[model samples]
Target: MSIATSPLPPTEAKEAAPFRPKAVTDFASAGLNPALIESLVLKYLLGVGVASGRKVAHELGLPFGPFPEFLRGLKAQQIVTYTDAAAANDYHFSLTDAGRARARGYLEECAYVGTAPVPFADYVASVEAQSIATENPKEADLRRAFSDLLISEDMFRMLGPAINSGKGLFLYGYPGNGKTSIAERITRCFGTTVWIPRTILVEGQILKLFDPANHEPIENVRSSLLREDDQDDRWVEIKRPTIVAGGELTMEALEIYYDRDNKICEAPLQMKSNCGTFLIDDFGRQRMAPIELLNRWIVPLEKRYDFLRLPNGKQIRVPFDQLILFSTNLEPKDLVDEAFLRRIPYKINASDPTEAMFRRMIEIFAPKLGFREIDQASVDHLIEHHYRRINRPFRCCQPRDLLLQVKNYCIYNDLPLEMKPEYFDFAAENYFTVL
Candidate 1:
């Protein structure tokens, strides 16, 4: 659960109309049948035993419009009766025997009882309005996203156009060269935040969308604060999502995952990553073969939309409107065919750092790793003996990783936290013992 709570960057002059889901003011605007809403209300009451009219409405994320008035209709039919008055002239209501039986039936059908789901149509509209394809990131945006890393000018030039393509690219080369790090930060080049539904209602089925493990919510932040009830609560504002799937990825993960006992569904990874970025890390080493995964995404890559079948076998078209990055140690040509390679326009190699760049990284990371300062002699000794002697290539990650090993050794031995030639030798001896 990566949390991106940073303030959004300045918008470009050509920004499109901002997307905001207005509070649904009626049953029609909610796009849900009244009977469905009624069933939800009853199920909520059955679970809690008793709650205020306003509490129920608030729990359901429908505090506006005729939702309260509809509750009165339930009271009129003796399904619910007022126990006591609540704040703001609301009433404490409890379910009758008939209501409890009905709620049990509804539970038997599907037991989901959290935030009300936004209609599938509304969700589709939101994705189109907030798609990353509309974004045009300039050099400044790329620099800001990669501010922490040392990006060479040539690499920056290659990355800017690739990010702007929004179709995605392959970040391929040697391992430990920051391919994953670069892929993770690419989303920051686009807009910082976008709204997504907590859950989606499609064809009478509820699909959970707001995964706490993937989406980070931005509370009380909105485009405007003038109106108290300006935006819909059904939708949550999240830091533009960067969903990463590495070696553990499987074919089942690409489709709608249904929980039989809960009678609930979790949206596919790509669906949750709409309007943001999806990184397929360690691409060739997934649980499934590379060709199988590539075949699954061929149409979505070309069409910018995907078709996913529901549990009932009905196929639904969903927007595939995210930057799909594939990060791998293997070469793009070796892992995928030319046809597949053509789909991904850019194939930027994350080459190993030059000797000078490697030393620069050591200088930058030493103090951050709690070393007071580093001497030139230790760096030279490290490069000359540990690297040159073994004919070892320089990796962008070696500076930090090797430094950590030295630091840990010093801490264990109660020695001063300073880089010394002896420490580098000790660190490299242990570090390079493995492949």
Candidate 2:
């Protein structure tokens, strides 16, 4: 397949350039879907076999016949070349220089927009500054780190005041109301390198300490700064201290472990989460009792600091700088008693959106995913028929999900990219439950 043409060079320098279409547009121009191009890039990077036309079809979930056409398009763009003549008739593909560049450029763009890669040591220091500043003017550092993209007007007001008050934040709402999305987005506000402790084998023993930046083993790390002549030049130092833990976190994961060889204890999750936001998503659904989790966190949550004792009877007071966000769909009263709830300084309810909001959200997501137009009336009809008729709460993610289903259906049936009422019927049947 031929590769797609590149977009024009960037016109102006930007602090953060908007996403410029290069490979994606190139493939689209050659009659391949942009999403298919992305899948190809991912499959190639993952080293999955892309040798047979049938295998490519199976892997990409596309029709078998179209695989040759897709490969031809890629070849035309010089993105891939077949090594053996026999492979030319098959899907055996390899990246050309231009193809590799396109893949790397696309990833760089994603990382630029999504993650802020900061040196591990600097990230730790910033988290400390943000946490300490929470009581005063310095709190801006921490406050800015927790900003969201599309927060409601009420939430913006509540969040700022609540954070300054040094109170915990509580976010609750119906499922698919963007509660978890909003919480996850907060991490983007900070520079990279969330501090998380990891288990490392030092001297043939497992000891958990603040993992060094860049996830390198302790033994491999250079102990001191070296001059050019003294340097081995074999290893490059990089710092990555950002830590995000969910799902598998236990009380033991939040404590110090004794490292007999190093004579130091491993730092727990709370310690690693310092200076970063610690989001407790699906708040009431953990295996641990809600009261137990709340009680364990009460002292540190209130004081913004915690103590950990070493095996040899030494203790260290670590700064608790993590901005804790509790996200749940369960009712506030059901999740915690009034007394415990009060300890959480800020409460933002991520309620279901109004009809107007839902419509706007659809309009926003439609064009991005190749939905040329959304039938507002059709969407409203479904909302009224499927959701309102059944007394289900309006969900923000519904539009995104519906668009995905429509896109998938179009691909499955080889239909033109258009939003039809049938798409909603399909979505409703597959996704929604009758109330």
Candidate 3:
């Protein structure tokens, strides 16, 4: 299928450019039913009571070509009447009694009244065009994405190829070792932004896709008031998503969610994370068994497509093109059998940091935590007394946690923001007691 593409050139340096969806002028080009568009106009008019032709078109995100002519046909049917003259040769329209009744019937079926949903076929094409598998992250891209972390050279080298693979991987180790953090940053290596439909329409069911909580929308700038944007407003430009699902994830979340009350459908978690990354954080800790969850995604992980059943019992295939990262505190072998393990090709251990790396973390975090200076003596004292003496293994998160304790103590005791050996002792005593 020939899909419409945006004319805007890529602005991001080095990152893979995303495929932008361009504006469509007619119902056929927009992949919308003329009958459906007419119903939407009436519904919108019923809601607001009175609105201009341009306003109705804008609200529906169908701002160009033959839409005004289409609205004129409603005026002929006596369903819409002109209330007042609007600018740009348009008129304010209100729904007649018959029109309101028709809209009420439409609402009874489904009350969706937003940007007309992109057709499912169009959404599938967008995912394939912007698939993460198409992008290859060099060492520079990895370094840029993970610049904030203190990753050792060996770990850095291991991550690049896995990200390049674009299949899936496991990040397993003990807790507080940056498994989730690493998974979240993996999307940055691919690109900065991608385009997704605000909602998708399949067999007349609206599937709400663009989520403000998970997807951050980038607003479009108009070049002039005389001309509308050439790009499709139905598709939102968003930062490359890194959707994290943890212990709260349920088996139901991996499928289509139909809201019986609203008569609308919500795209599942994997659908929301398309063209980017989906991090299953605290993987083994979810309510479902690891094997069950693995079974659900086993086919999609390899085939790069998924099947979802609508409330009407009709099945549809959607592109499952995302970098899946499974992060857990438990070992991979303990979570699933060898067959499942083979699917997730890379298993990188988030091992405990060396004493030197731990010290570096302390040095990096000390200043950020309001310590005026790092005392080499105080750090050495902290390591020797708190860690070495107790035979405590160093976790990557200890520096930040220990420093917060010391900082809070300084505030409580009205002491200077200095890293004193005594402060380290106090912090270590309180911080390590539970762990």
Runs with alpha carbons beyond 4 Å of true place in candidate 3: 1-18
Evaluated against the true structure, the overall lDDT of model 2 is: 0.57
- What shift in Å separates residue 421 of candidate 2 from its native position after superposition? 0.7
**Residues 188-290, candidate 2, lDDT per residue (tens digit)?**
4444432232322222222344455414332434343211122222122223233445555567767776544334345576665555566777887777778
Prediction-by-prediction clash tally:
0, 28, 0
RMSD of each: 6.4, 20.0, 4.1
Q: Which pairs, if any, clash in model 3?
A: none
Q: What is the alpha-carbon lDDT for the whole of candidate 1?
A: 0.89
TM-score of each: 0.94, 0.57, 0.94
Please report, in order, the local distance difference test score of every candidate based on alpha carbons.
0.89, 0.57, 0.88
Backbone clash pairs for candidate 1 read none
Candidate 3 lDDT at 20 equals 80
* Candidate 3 Cα deviation (angstroms), residue 133: 0.7
lDDT of 1 at 425: 90
Instruction: Estimate, for each residue in 116-217, the C-alpha lDDT of model 1 and write its tens digit.
Output: 889999999999889899899899999999999987788999999999999889999999999999998998999789999999999889999999999999
**lDDT top scorer:** 1
